[model samples]
Target chain A: MATETAAATGGQASPIALEEAGICVDSHGGAIGLPQLCPDWMGNQIFWLAVTLVIIFFVLSRIALPRIAAVLAERQGTITNDIAAAEDLKVKASEAEAAYDKALADARSDAQAIVAQTKADIKADLDAAMAKADAEIAAKTAEGEKAIAEIRAGALDAVKEVAKDTAREIVAAMGGQADAKTVNAAVTSQMKG
Target chain B: MATDVNGAAEQSGGLVFHPMDQFIIKPLFGDGGVGIFTVTNITLWMAITVLATIALLVLGSSSRSTIPTRMQSIAELAYGFIRKMVEDVAGRDALPYFPYIMTIFMFVVMANFVGLLPGAFTSTSHIGVTAVLALLVFFSVTIIGFVKHGAGFLSLFWISAAPLPLRPILALIEVISYFVRPVSHSIRLAGNMMAGHAVMKVFAAFAPMIIISTGIGLVVTPLSILAIAAIYALEVLVAFIQAYVFTILTCVYLKDALHPAH
Candidate 1:
């Protein structure tokens, strides 16, 4: 009802004023009268579209790219640092290996010297024992020879006593008168022989 | 009866409701709230927008040389302008969204310009059109936020930098803000287009009056012509500005969606 009144008012007033002013205005094909498929829809589309576009702009520009770049840069830095560290470690390892080899060589030489010294000591001890055994055998042989010479001398002395005794007994049986001269001569001859 | 009708009409507010008219074009609907459906009118405009953007972009990009042509320079200027805007608003993280931003700016700028054509339909004039576009953005951004942060996206509305005691109040504000997105998004474009057209109509309605007088008619008619010319130029500037404003807002929204800081 209100719309009808407003429309009637507009219709009456606009035409009357135009006629009074000796002018006829045709508003049929005016910009406002164009048949739109959906004004509300069009308006909404435009509004929401603008919003969406802005959102997309904000997200891509501010958040995602910077983080990605930062992560990439950090990764690159870490990788480079790791490579450098590995190189340094390699050099250090090589130096350590060299030092280890030198120490091993020195230890090996030291061990060889100790072994040679021990072998020499053992050889000397063996030679000394052999020399001592030879000395003992020589001393025993000399003592045995000395004992044999003494025994021969005693046997000879006994033999001589027995011969004299036998000669005396034979003389005494033969003649009393020639006993003393015979005994003396026999004794003298025995001394000269 | 006519007098009574007028009296009653005057008592009530002057509200015109046309039930026979299709308020918002429903290009797509289904029996159940399911499946893909197409919106014909919007789809047509969308295609038009895309083609117009491609035309401009292709033409602009075709002239590639050490010494750039005017068209190329203009394109470059637009690119640089949006790029700077994104950088300033979203920071350095906005590079990947560059394509989308550029596309939005180009599409909107073209749509606005097309409205200025002699007999072209102003697509942004309707609320339904604006609503769809707004809803698209709203849903897209919300989905993006969820995809990126999963369940944590809800925290954006619930949490803020405010103190514990003030958190509830802040949460309420956040919720209001979230709901208001579609309204603001739709209103901005509709408001600009409506205001511009209304003013133009007011000025144009005066054209016949100025031409009716004999001696004054000559002076007034040209003056009206000049006014129209001036208004038209202003409208052009407005068109470009509206497009830029729309695209910028979209960028801002997208930034929040991606980040979603309390």
Candidate 2:
């Protein structure tokens, strides 16, 4: 308070400057009191404040605010679109995976079917070859039996002839001739017994 | 004078404390009266604040890229912060007024932070500036309330939840408090800014204590400096908090105007 009143005896340089400075600054360019309370500067301060607020509001509303809002909205839209695309890609990828799995399963079943067909074909061929081989062996065994029978018959006939000839030779040597009929009958009876 | 030499230690050299002088509205150029048209420090600082707002809001978002740059992201963050505030506090219906709220937030924040620069004048510290900001909010909210609800806006002062007999008293209190909103709002910001700056100035005045007396100065100067640093950090926090408080309060007031039920 003393400092404020001391300004009454302040510098006598210019009373106008003193009044314009308001009761805020002292003669020595120091603050006499709170400058905020001075009424002289309030008008210009408010005026400038108004100008500033107006400028800021104008720039923000007209340019900055809209620009920022658009950028944000655009960014949001891009994110949403990107997310949607990712979801679509994910669906497609899953579909492809499903298709791949189905293909693999089909190939496996087809391979199994092929293996079964080949096994059946091989079994049929083996059964047919074994049957043909058994038929050939049976035919060869029948022929061998017939040949052996024929040979035995021929040997029996030869034995009968030998008996008849031996009887004739014995009869000639002993002065007694035997008949062929009698020799044949004796040989037949002996073979039967 | 007794003012300069209050203490005996002041007798050595004149100790003048011009803490309030930083707030004096001086013309940027020559000595002149601060007429409404006169270009003062207020204009300069306010212009700087305006430029900063433009730089952050306009130029920063020029890319409009989905992958935002730092400046763009900062701009977006500020926008989203205030937009969400207006949406949450004032309701979605108040989105049309978002730009206005955004302007207030950016200006106050920029003015505060910019004013923290050394030797800089704090515009928001002055009642002249804060009063206008507060009054703008006050008038706009009131007008919007009346426009939206007509006489129904008065319901805000009438607490429907209160007992019928006590309703009148509560309404009276509400009306008075509602009227005091501008005063409190403006004073809250200005007082915070003024108090912080003044306290810092007082601390700074002690920074030269060593020049006064090496004996007392040795301890006092370092302490004062440390106090200044500590207060500076606090002031930085106060600066942002005050701006947030001002904007959020604006949003709250706007909500009352929009709803006005209780």
The most accurate candidate by DockQ is 2
Off by over 4 Å in 1: A1-193, B1-51, B211-223
Candidate 2: where are CA atoms >4 Å away?
A1-8, A11-22, A147-192, B6-16, B210-220
Please give the distance, in angstroms, between residue B220's alpha carbon in candidate 2 and its true position after superposition.
4.1
* TM-scores for all predictions: 0.49, 0.85
For candidate 1 chain A, the 10 contiguous residues with the lowest summed lDDT are A23-32
Instruction: Give the lDDT of residue B14 in candidate 2.
Output: 42
**Tens-digit per-residue lDDT, B2-88, candidate 1:** 233434544563222221122223344431211123343444555566556544445554534434567655655676787788887
Superposed by TM-score, candidate 1 places the C-alpha of residue B164 at a distance from the truth, in angstroms, of: 1.7
Question: Native contacts retained per candidate?
Answer: 0.07, 0.69
TM-score of 2: 0.85
Task: Tell how far residue A73 is off in model 2, in angstroms.
Answer: 1.9
